[model samples]
Target chain A: MKNKKPELVTTAATLEEVERVFEAGADAVTLGHERYALRQPGHFELEQIKEAQQIARKHGGRVYAVMNALMHHDEVGELAGYLEQLAPHVDAVVFGDPSVLMTARQVAPELPLHWNTETTSTNYRTVNFWAGKGASRAILARELSLEAVLEVKRNTRIEIQVQVHGMTCIFHSKRELVSNYVRHQGKDPEQEIRAAQRRMFLKEDNREDQRYPIFEDRHGTHIMSAEDICMLEHLSSFITGGIDALKIEGILKPLEYIQTVVSIYRKAIDRLAENPHADIDSGWLDELKSIQDPARPLGTGFYFKQQIY
Target chain B: MLTQTVQSTIASPTKRKKPELLAPAGNLEKLKFAVLYGADAVYIGGQKFGLRSKAGNFTYEDMKEGVAFAHAHGAKVFVAANIIAHNEDFEGMEEYFRTLYDIGIDAVIIADPAIVEVCKQAAPHLEIHLSTQASTTNWQAVSFWANEGISRVVLAREVSMEEIRQIKKYTDVEIEAFIHGAMCISYSGRCVLSNHMTNRDANRGGCAQSCRWKYDLFEEAEEEDTETPQIGKTELPMFSEEDDSFTMSSKDLCMIEHIPEMIEAGVDSLKIEGRMKTVHYVATVVNTYRKVIDAYCEDPEGFVFKPEWMDEILKAANRPVTTAFYYGSPTEQDQIFGVPPKMAKYDFAGLVLDYDEKTGIATIEQRNHFAVGSEVEFFGPKRDNFIQKVEELWDEEGNSLTEANRAMQKVKMRVTQPVKPYDIMRKEKK
Candidate 1:
């Protein structure tokens, strides 16, 4: 518990967006590809990250490095060393790989790191399990509504970070389509044709369809792209609730998605500056639905134990 | 017994008792057509829980009435309520189970283990067929479910036939193999790509099928720049780094020639996977296999498969047919999932218009070409009664017609004798 502070952390892959999130009132910025990978190798080298850290520090915002993707052990060790060199400038590192966390602890024992949600840190047992692994905080599953989140936080010592607003991932874990993309491309004539049989998918400028679906058979590709996740209406209640970190997810969403989402969420958060009320003003819900969400359906999330309807 | 039905009918010719020709019936008309064409037992989904969401899934009212209708004709109906459920979704199941129980539907095919537990609690008398979504790939998995009181288990298509024999040995569970239909790229229908890429979960029946979509990636080229630089003697790409990688997709599943081998594996039931498909696909594919399975059953020793039947199987709107993982072991070469042939020889337009009892007249509405010389198969009532011969054809005006070619072509037909309503009329494609 970094002094038991309520840190409004917004995750982003780009520095410019991180700056925008801070301007919108983020307490800290967690960097990694939140479904958006960094295009340049290692995404950005240590020097580039150091520059981003300086920008974040200027606004009194902390920088948290995120290594969410599946990484090789050696590469993780190398990054751990690089991260150690950047330790004096950065805050905690959000991590999942056992090796990466071990190396981070070995290299810079003082740096704080939260266990990434890839570890499926849901129950108190799991949260405490990761805590034993040296994780100070745990990101709760997006599908667990408000009440569920509070239950876990109450039971576990690790602080809770809930996805406040962003794209909801139904493909939570397991890498089938991506693996197919990486493995089956180029050579086989059969695979080339099947890819053509698939439907089209566009997420933040990334589009591909293997005519044949990567998962379920011939009924085309079974997929659902719902709207973005927006919790504006439920914010006051969530803040009053046990959530420690309010997260806005979109490293790959457009600049407009990043900016508008940050601004709206910022206003909603500020609305609760005095007493946190549970009432969700209808206008906030409307504004959220009006936004262009390329992801699947948006949910108020299973956060509130109280299903208002 | 039923001699006039066997040799003169069916695909190849079976040496032993013919495997039941299980066919799909999405609607009442298709159900009638299926039974008349010698379907041993028919499988369908009532509106609630079946694999094919787009199917004319059965409603409660439809199931109650449909079950009675199927039973009147001396056939069986297995209702599908295979939707996967989470804890919160288990509220109204008591009534759902009782409703299915009262309807007299032969059995309910279930997917989720939770739902199976629910069914056991709610409807103790009801029989259960475990849906393919259970992904029973091993003998242990099959026997485990069987111990839980599953009457039949639809084996995952990925399992090899060798495993089937092994599974059969360990458990008394009736194994149902998908004799034909679409292929799943993910292992055992549990891909989150649907829920992840889209909020649709394939396991829960609301799969938006995200795997079928095409995505482009930059493939790391073979000739890495000598500068494919080792930053710290590591080969992995750095995070946040962009690389141009390419992607590919998987193909559909089809197995027509390997029926003999699959039958040899001791499957109690053979399943065909096209609930969302049209009636024409059902009739054509069912009739083709019906003939082949019968041939194999008739002459266990003296049977040679006719090559023309393979050509007949391809006439369906199919992707490239692979034997699937049915042989001793599936080789990499056995995996054939490419683009489907752009053209189909048959469109399976519509059902036979009607049938005359005395004159044995069956009317046909053509979805494809039916020539005087071209053989049209009459899949008649009960197993082993489907007939293949184009001795004659009559037009709508009752004039004996030679050829009827167009979309929705109707013709009056005079069969040898005794044709009943609900008999399917399909012409062999090749």
Candidate 2:
């Protein structure tokens, strides 16, 4: 299957757990800070990242170090310089921004660069263009349907990874999910208020999210970017189509989340391997419906004919 | 007059000045290149405090030296502390801002109110360039940022020149627009493709760039491998379709041909998008735009950009240049689905291997796998292009042959006239 897991990422799977998940049919683990901005002075502490890399060694899972929401240009090189310490230990460092890609290329020529979807790579030229800049892979936009993905694949030799399951960017990766958190608490608001204030942009809570301010497109700003993409039905295409990986988004969930998602894809992967193209059992889809992917809003995502099921 | 200058309405900025070509310098070399090439100001980042954290972002020493170099070259430097700052991120770049401001960095692009308030207190004298991440598609948003003492606004790339004219009419803040390069797929630069797959928000400039990934399509409406009939249809079925517009992708932006409209609309500074591009990329693009702009300035009405300029521009390096959003709403015609990457064509013609004025033939290293009878387009400086078919191809030893595939091998070819040291040769794609 083309589904190798587009550079697997997860907070749920540890080095060993991740190895088993991949062995059990997981593809890659995108390492992100579950604590989020709560980590330290930076998006992540270098030592913590180093430890994650060390742990990732056991699984042989390609470690895609997630450092996507940084605003400072300085951090590009700093994080890249930091990644240089990891060397090939970290399989790829996913990042957005043309400028950041340039820095990563100069710093770690051998280490693969995966273009972050935040960089908004939506077409064949972008794929080939970034591929020319040393990008080996991309996290396809969730908004893209299966046909679009195939079109993107045809444009370049770069590997295509799809999100089969996970928490999607609520504002399509733009607005800070926690902006309200910043505004009300900018200098001061109570702890609960502070918690309530977290916004996707402001790092504060977004009151706009509740009332859902109108989006610029004259649409609603009810943040919608990252959504869960579970193709339990099309697991066979995930393999035979040459997808390097099938990613599961949320690592913040309980280990049960990990166990359930990894185990399901594993079974599906096996089934597909045995019978190159087959339908998934209805019961399995029902069981998945019971899981904690409510945040994903239940869509098969873009890789399908993309019906609004 | 001196006293009124400080108090004048037109001069609200305590540090008032006309905005210049604010270019994104992705690396040390590009920093110098941009400054020398014609940029009045350059924006950069060290290890942490800028939006394009992924551009060949400068190192501490690289940034420091770049600042110094630009200052030395009569240019200004702006540090991007533009990312939306969190409580933790505040501490990460707090000291850097103070130090940079104290050391004479021209400005700092900012968005988050928290960051702005912090900078106001921390680096009071530091000028602020509001980033495009703020999504200032309207004058209200511009007015909002302007209220915060923002001196310049990098208006969202999606806004049209007419809208920009309206914004310039309303706001006193200097406006900057991205005149060239790759554009983001989301509205106003707010994307979360990264955080969805990896907890990275694109707006804070930490985008995982999910828009670029290749995907495989299975028609979800059906169970089998059969082609879903409506798969390639571009028209939305309106009321019959789902609630969402079902957009497939975002378009690339380029306003090069529309320089006059942008200038007339009141953009103070023109911006180019590649921060991670190579020097070759910067030089070719910057030089091309520079020529185009000069051409327009020379004759606004009578002058027209020749198709040859656009063709030569294609050779410089590009993603099929399109007039994204500027002309009207972008559609599939602008989209490049399966086009083979256009490259520096005409292969390596004879280098300055030997320029013998006595004989018009310039000995060149044969570039492509060429046979004796292939027609190739030759390119040189100053509107130089011609269809020159290779009537004959002979080896270095003077043996006439059908083709030459050997590496570093030399071949003799005749030209209409003698070629110069910096002249280049290429072939057009059929």
Top candidate when judged by lDDT against the true structure: 1
- Measured with C-alpha atoms, the lDDT of residue B52 in candidate 1 is 68
Off by over 4 Å in 2: A1-309, B1-19, B215-251, B338-430
Residue lDDT tens for model 2, B1-430: 8778556644433222333566778888788767765577888776775677677877667767898899998989877766644223556556777877766788887765556666777788898888877656666556656766788888766666667777787668889888877777555555554544444555556676554442211111212433432122221111122221122233355666777787678788888877887654564456566666666655566668777666556665556667765655454444443333465543443333565787677666655465567665554434345667777766778788787677557877766666664344454444
Model 1, B67-123: lDDT tens digits are 777788677888777765433455677688888888887777887655776788899
Q: Candidate 2, residue A269: CA error in Å?
A: 41
Error of 1 at B171 (Å): 2.4
Best by TM-score: 1
* True lDDT of residue A61, candidate 1: 85
Candidate 1 Cα misplacement greater than 4 A, ranges: A1-309, B1-21, B72-74, B196-201, B219-250, B327-339, B349-362, B365-423, B426-430
